[model samples]
Target: MKPLDPRLLRRARGARVFLAASVLIGVASGVLIVVQAVLLAHGITGVVLRGSGVSGVALGLALVVAGRALLVWAQEVVAQRAAAAVKSTLRRQVLEHSLKLGPVWLSGERSSALTTLLTKGLDDLDPYFARYLPQLVLASTVPAGVIGWMATGDLIAAGTVLVTLPLIPIFMALIGWATQARSRRRQHALAVLAHHFADVVGGLTTLKLFGRAKAQESAVRRVTDQHRAASMGSLRLAFLSSFALELLASISVALVAVGVGLRLVDGKLGLETALMVLILAPEAYLPLRQVGLQFHASADGVAASEEVFRVLETPLPMRGDRTDVPDLRVSPLQLYDVTVRYTGRDEPALDGFDLELRPGEVVALTGPSGAGKSTALAVLLGFVEPERGVVVAGGSAADEFDPIEWRRQFAWVPQRPGLRLGSIADNVRLGRPTASDDEVRLALLTAGAGELALDKPVGEQGQLLSGGQQRRVALARALLTNAPVLLLDEPTAGLDPDAEAAVISGLRATGRTVLMVAHRPALIAAADRTVSVGARELVNA
Candidate 1:
């Protein structure tokens, strides 16, 4: 992204407002700076050349200095607030758009990377908004105003500033390119380290069981060393750039000072006018120098925001505006000639896959692993769009109904359920947040989890519960939804025979249109009919 990316203004309303306010503040600051310099120059001339009394000029000088300080404080306040607002807006948009993209797309992304981007990555933008951007605005406004004011006093100083000012930005651009590259490298290193650490933590138990936990020490050390090296490299470049900008600005200002001093020695210029020109010379170069320095601080943030924009710009699947979906209790659901090919896969996940689901019947999809049984469920749930076919519901295409509204018709139980850190009752209530305690208990009983207490705590991802217990809680949550259709993937896999029997009995009792992926003979036997998938043609048994 550029120093001032227009996409930011388009994506974040706060950025546009901040920009406008910064412009106004920058102009006001410039006016104050010029007035302060004029007063100081006059006071110095009177004291040294005319030997005039200091009473009048002293009060005005004090007021102008205080006003300038107040303006600086105001800029700080506005910049901080704007940074907070923009970060909040960007975070919300990224999260919302990720959900809209659905699980299939997210499956390909690293959760750790996304987490780091949302947290530490976006937080880096604070310096960009709070320091770099304000300086950038000042660089544009203050230089021109200072130069123009100087011109009215001494054209020689003004012309000298005009010729030297462009050099700062020119050097800034060249150095900025290198700084941005370093920043990007550092950011990438940080993300890689974060992803590796998360993976190690998540699978630490398995690693220890295999006696490979110790082996990861070297790997982690390697990644950490890489990140440290990148960070140091970026810091070195920042220091060098700051030094270079300071040197350039000092030389530029010294040139103006030299000429004014020489002319004053020759009696070619008034002392007051010479002092004013000299005082304002450094002011012209100050903003640009600060911009160069702050740019390094904001570089990481710029790189992070570019990644955020890429995600926000990704296109979502086509969904209709229609909210009036037909009732799943009576409507027939059908997938006609649907084909889905995932990236980097030679074979399509689903090819010419056709299926029909009738109302109030338990239909089992039995297929070998990698046969796209879960993919079929995803298609029906509107989580994946078929590349070459359409889903029909009650004689209307599925895409014709809004995806959110359409998903409301079915309760889904994936192979691995996501449970939060909460009580069993809290997790169950997720299916229907307003469900009463009794309703939750009943659902748990029906799903063969009646032995578990409602207030029992489940740690993150239900780690506190046994595998079978976690499955039952997920089943209970799905059962509590009271939707017209049930989509289950290996719902009975982790259950004991008795528990499986209880769950199958519950499904029969509910009489909802059920479609489940089943590998167990018991699950297949429980279905009213079974369809054998992955064959040249689907076979009904």
Candidate 2:
């Protein structure tokens, strides 16, 4: 388990108020417990011993029972509210920060890990947040109170409690090291399971067609068995830790009990004082021990959350060089000698590349696979940065421009476009959320998107549509944006010849500056010019 990621717990101002209420719950619970203990010791020594009225005895018992019950219930309610605040705010923060990280961040990490952090890891935090949490403060403060009160009875008893308490934390810390390692390993195995399971399910159709799915049964079983083993290992460690802590606590309480009884027998302490020591001893260690146990659970969430924070913290390479793409006085884009190199690789993708795109000209970049075609497109879209050169537009540096505000000037449709779960209209509206219905229809027509499928459900990742239809939906989204520049990567690869022709025709008529990666000969011929990139030489296609 890892230390808590401070950012995960820091959230909306109101969450602090919820934390305050959780603290109040702990304080109230402690006081109520102390009162209930006194009432029991008093009631057991009863009205006969005190020579008191029956009404006084009955009323005292009623107040003790009702107050304890009410205080426990109130504490639970407040703890639950605090847990809700932590979960809700952390989730919101993850999503909002994710948008800033851009596609590069998503590309590197497993989607399943992100899903786990957002769902399962955060879910596991509930117990610590609600129950064992406030005691983090109470455990320290209440123990001192417990010892102080015990000193009044017999100073030696207070000394015993104080001296033994440090041993609990010492043992806990030593065990915590092994527990943290096991928890990290367990979390990693879980992430692998989630990622593999997602991949297997997503590609189930392919596996079935190849008749290799049956062979995969053993593989899946192995992964599942690994997950189970890791889970059991974590559980075993947790249970052992809990047992050990409880055993130590029981010993401490028993020692206190024996000491108090001896003092009482010797007449050095009264019956009430001896009983108080018996009652308060557990209350003191209970919070501290519970906190140590919960530390295991909270540590997993903290580890996962820190990973999320790491992704959200990476910076984008470069941005658009201008405030506005189409200014009255200057061109939208100006690509100076640009160079881009991937980390841990010596080969540069775009070595001294150059391009100057205007408002209405369509440019085509055609090349064999891995010949820097996609890298060029990535540079234009501000997804990757050139290592040694500057990209200037409208007399401004690309680094200074805001990618969020400037990326709005274009739309992108990858060859394998994916649709989110929603209606066709909902998917298209993502391009231009404020777009009118009529505008969506026009963009659909311009992108060769079918009119009939406009209102139909696309299903998850646009499974309901043919490959061509999915591409068109993405194109329709781009069209709706009315961006000055459009990027279409392998737009016609999986289409029938007619569908390919239609896709090309729609691109030619879009009347916006396009920088597309083309494989179709028709699209290449239709372009005003094409750049061919290969080892022999770079030339016009």
TM-score of every prediction relative to native: 0.96, 0.89
lDDT of 1 by residue, 1-541 (tens): 3879899999888899989999998999999889989989989988998899888888998888888888788888988888899999999999999998877788887889999999999999999999999999999999999999999989998999999999999999999889888988999999999999999999998999999999999999999999999999999999998999999999999999999999989998899999899888989999999998899899999999998998899888888989989999999999898888887998999888888898998999988898889889989988888888999998899999988899999999988888999999999999999999999999999888899999999998898998889988998999899999999999998788998999889888888999999998888998987876666365555
The window of 10 residues in a row where model 2 has the poorest summed lDDT is 321-330
- Candidate 1 lands at a TM-score of 0.96
Best by TM-score: 1
Worst lDDT window (10 residues) for model 1?
A: 532-541
Name the lDDT value of residue 195 in candidate 1: 98
**What local distance difference test score does each model get?**
0.91, 0.74
lDDT, model 2, position 89:
75
Which is the leading candidate under lDDT? 1
Q: Candidate 2's C-alpha lDDT? A: 0.74
The local lDDT score (0 to 100) that residue 518 gets in candidate 2 is 90
